[model samples]
Target: MSGSEIVGDIAEGALLARAVEPAAGEAPDGHTQETACLNCGTTLCGSHCHSCGQAAHVHKTLAAFFHDLLHGVFHFEGKIWRTLPLLVWRPGLLTREYIDGRRASYVSPIALFLFVVFLTFALFNLAVGPIHVEPSAVIAAKSGGVQAEADAARELATTEARLARARRGAADRRSGKRTGVRS
Candidate 1:
């Protein structure tokens, strides 16, 4: 048989199997099933709906949730492998291909962005511990308290005086006034 005919046969067989098998979300006790799509009321054929593409199985188990998380991070149908090189080295080409609708071969930009951001945050948190600020009391305890306060006050006054002089200089320049000092 030709390739197209073979594919058609497989599809027909799948549909027949779906018809014969118990629908999803059924308990198999001869009662009506709630397997109908919540989004569009179509019978789901597999894990996802053929009508609306929403997931047919909404897993409530913790194991299933972790499985989905790992699958999303690591599986992703090898699209990340294809997208990363173009994203890092040839971003313009990536943008062009996505804009031109040649997208089946690579991850979508939004998906890639989200994945990258998640990966970045995960790695950052793993590598760097949370920042802890030393309170002023702790800092004062470390440095001699009275001396540290006096030094900080002196530095602040010096900084304020410098800033005031700079502001006066700028105002003088803007008003086209010159100090009486010779060049």
Candidate 2:
């Protein structure tokens, strides 16, 4: 083909491609998709809404859900890196800085607290399994000999009586009849 005709064809192809491609912040369809804050109706430009602090985009996929969870739990990004030093060595300075509104560089106090608590509990659970105990052994250790046996018998009798009373009260309530019990 001649140079002029080739150029014309390329321009036409470019126009067609541009027409088919969606614009930024738009869905596949021709309509302009809302990247606005679902909570407050403000236009969103980043990961979170500027006006309401809500996430701009919510992921519907399971992989994205897990990615978010992992990111939240483990990813310190730049905030933790900036906050940790001051928090560990000069907490007063950190607090002062945060209170003075120089907060963009550091993690928020509540977020740091929650993350530390979560980390502590997660580590503790990993290090130590659920506690197990034998009820008879525990009771025997607390009490000794005939006294222990007598205490156990008394406790069993009391428990049985309480259970019987509870059952009677439930029955009365179900039957829509008033019993001697106040409730």
Candidate 3:
């Protein structure tokens, strides 16, 4: 593969990973539990134990892991769905709200990008209409955009061939030999 293709793959992988992962410090259970008591030795529960204000609970389960995973995905999807309509129409509202820390109400950028990419590719493949056009003036017009690139490539090849001939002639002159000439 080309360098750009490799780079693109890496970038795509990174973006997908970002979309799949949860943000840092975002509590899975929306609550933090304390490990130990300050005044007396007591097992903590729910932010505080009524006796002291300490954190509560910790994540420790396979179910909890999967739950957090689903939570992240659905949370992101929910935000995207809510923000997408307004984003498509207003545009400014989504940006402003996001900048103003209304992030909880909207999908993150990476998530939205991934979702959009996935949807676009899926829809494109599933689309049944005129996916392939018959060869005609319309098709020619569509291809005309690439005509200049083809012309440039032809010109480059011609120039390179001319340069090669010139180099060969120069080498013959330096060696005092006549090329392509009968004795």
Candidate 4:
């Protein structure tokens, strides 16, 4: 048979074998059996169980999905808090130290940067609301600069009107009530 036909035959054979031996350690949905903790052999409860710290997780479980989501979101599982102060005070000391290969002891700089960014965004959302904005835009929008400008224009108009009235009074004095000019 041709290579394509041979490959197709092999795939059919494998599918037949899978259908025949469905319970040979495969879940109905194709998931493999869950493994217990290596150290304690107890069925792990979740990612790092309370009993033996075994990660009782499969890639497809709802709980595992949520666990990963929460881990990504909160991010301070332990390392973020430890590294932040050092990052702020020491500056490139972190980048330098990490680059030197003394790695196993701290959060990765990328991870730390992500954590800070997530924290800043979370705090910003909590403080502001659903709407996203720059602080400068928000401040500029709230400030009364437009109203102030309008007030200034009104004031200029008022001053001009007052100056006109004063000029009219002076003209009346000059023409009608004249100071006697004896040449």
- Each prediction's TM-score versus the true structure: 0.36, 0.36, 0.32, 0.31
Q: For model 3, state the Cα shift of residue 27 in Å.
A: 18
Q: Give the C-alpha lDDT of model 4.
A: 0.63
Clashing pairs in 4: 46-56
Summarize candidate 4's per-residue lDDT along 1-183 as a digit string, tens digits: 899999999899879976987654356644444556443456655654455453443334555546655655555466566567777898587667555433333565555657678889999889987885899997887677887898999999999999997787787786776544331
lDDT of 3 by residue, 1-33 (tens): 999999999899868866876462366564334
Q: What lDDT does candidate 2 reach at residue 106?
A: 69
Error of 4 at 176 (Å): 51
Off by over 4 Å in 4: 1-77, 132-183
What's model 1's lDDT at 46? 73
Residue-wise lDDT of candidate 1 within 2-104, one digit each (tens)? 9999999989987887687746335444333346665466786776568656455444345665765665565468678888899899999988875643555
Clash tally for model 2: 0
Give the least accurate 10-residue stretch of model 3, judged by summed lDDT: 52-61
Candidate 3: regions farther than 4 A off: 1-74, 128-183
**Clash number for each model:** 0, 0, 6, 1
In model 4, how large is the Cα lDDT of residue 100? 48
- The alpha-carbon deviation from the true structure for residue 126 of candidate 1, after best TM-score superposition, in angstroms, is 1.2
Note the Cα lDDT for every prediction shown.
0.69, 0.72, 0.64, 0.63
Q: Indicate the TM-score of model 2.
A: 0.36
lDDT string, candidate 2, 92-157, tens digits: 999987665354566767667779898898898889976688998888877777787898999999
